[model samples]
Target: MIVVVGITVGILDVCELGSHFILMSITIACGMLSEAYARGPPAPNASTHHSERQIPFAACDIAQLLIALCWGITGDIAEIVSRARIAQLWAATGVAVAYMSIARWLGNVIIFDRKKSRFVANAVYGLAFVPYATSWCALIARFALAINGAEASVPDWIIAIVIGMFFGFTGTFPIIHALSINRVIDVDAAEVAYAIAGVANKSLLGWYMWYGVNRMQTA
Candidate 1:
């Protein structure tokens, strides 16, 4: 229902503001919910065995890495040489982070059987859309751009790598939580796996983005 409403409003421009982000959040939230349902209820005597505990965390880590790589490459390809590129990257990152956070929150609420007031749940859902209209993501992008401006001739690949790494690292927490909610892995082991995957993903994406950017800059 939440997903359907969000998609409808986004398509119809019912809110006319930040509909993209709202739709994204709703999609992610729904994905999490579906996964939780697929996993069914936790066993009453569920015990975390060593191998069982490791598998989901490992899988989540791999999934996050792939997701990060895809996003990073897409951003790199979309980036223009103007200052607006920074803003674009930041906005994209903010949306990704927001989606992950909302999904994780929803998953946690479902998994733990915690009750939330309708107002509170709606408020949490609203957080995903806030970044779309907020200046904070842009501000952060500006700060980052300013720091990087000192080195004008830095290779495009180097810049790509740095941006990918930053966003990838920042996004890990929520990814882990989402995985946990899906019962993919125990939450406690998620940090290490997700971190490792983030690093790998970002590093590869940086190289790939660099290649693309270099080609464009030289052309």
Candidate 2:
């Protein structure tokens, strides 16, 4: 299924979509690593506790950083665009880590009571995506522009909000699915939904950034 999705997305445009997928993969990996770390190590019984194997968080984080660097290098090669400096890239990564940490914290606090209607529950979860995506877009755009020596504009914020809402709406799919399956919503469940939705959403966002945003810039 992932391969099929990747092939379809790659067909749209390789460099942009590929870069987006790489970044999303890194984020997802980090999330999973963090979760595993929180869960602790597996028991000595290898057969019974097979699912408990986990990579160290520090190792996963370093690997994710390297992946980002490689993606930047690939983007530069494919697009003939200047890559962000290593320092800038590191800064952006720090921002991302901080953002995810906050989002997770927020998810923990904001409970979606199962007693509420699905519409209400979904709406609550959907609303969270607005700010989450918006801030992410804004930070990335701002940093990219700054690194490229371009002036930031008001439209950047507007564009971020538009894209954020798009992601938010699309992101509701997993949450709705989870709700239907479990008849309730919780932080962990919602986080899983968000992670799942992220794969698809980021793919679409990649295409948008490549075709739509890039075209607008050239025009």
Per-residue lDDT over 54-127 for candidate 2, one digit per residue giving the tens place of the 0 to 100 score: 21224343344334333432332222124335433432343234323322222222221112243244335444
- Local distance difference test scores for all models: 0.40, 0.37
Measured against the true structure, the TM-scores of the candidates, in listed sequence, are 0.31, 0.29
Lowest-sum lDDT 10-residue window in model 1 = 50-59
Residue 82 CA displacement from its true place in model 2, Å: 6.1
Task: State candidate 1's TM-score.
Answer: 0.31
Candidate 1 lDDT tens digits, 48-79: 34212221222343344345445533443233
Count the clashes in each prediction.
0, 0
By TM-score, the best candidate is: 1
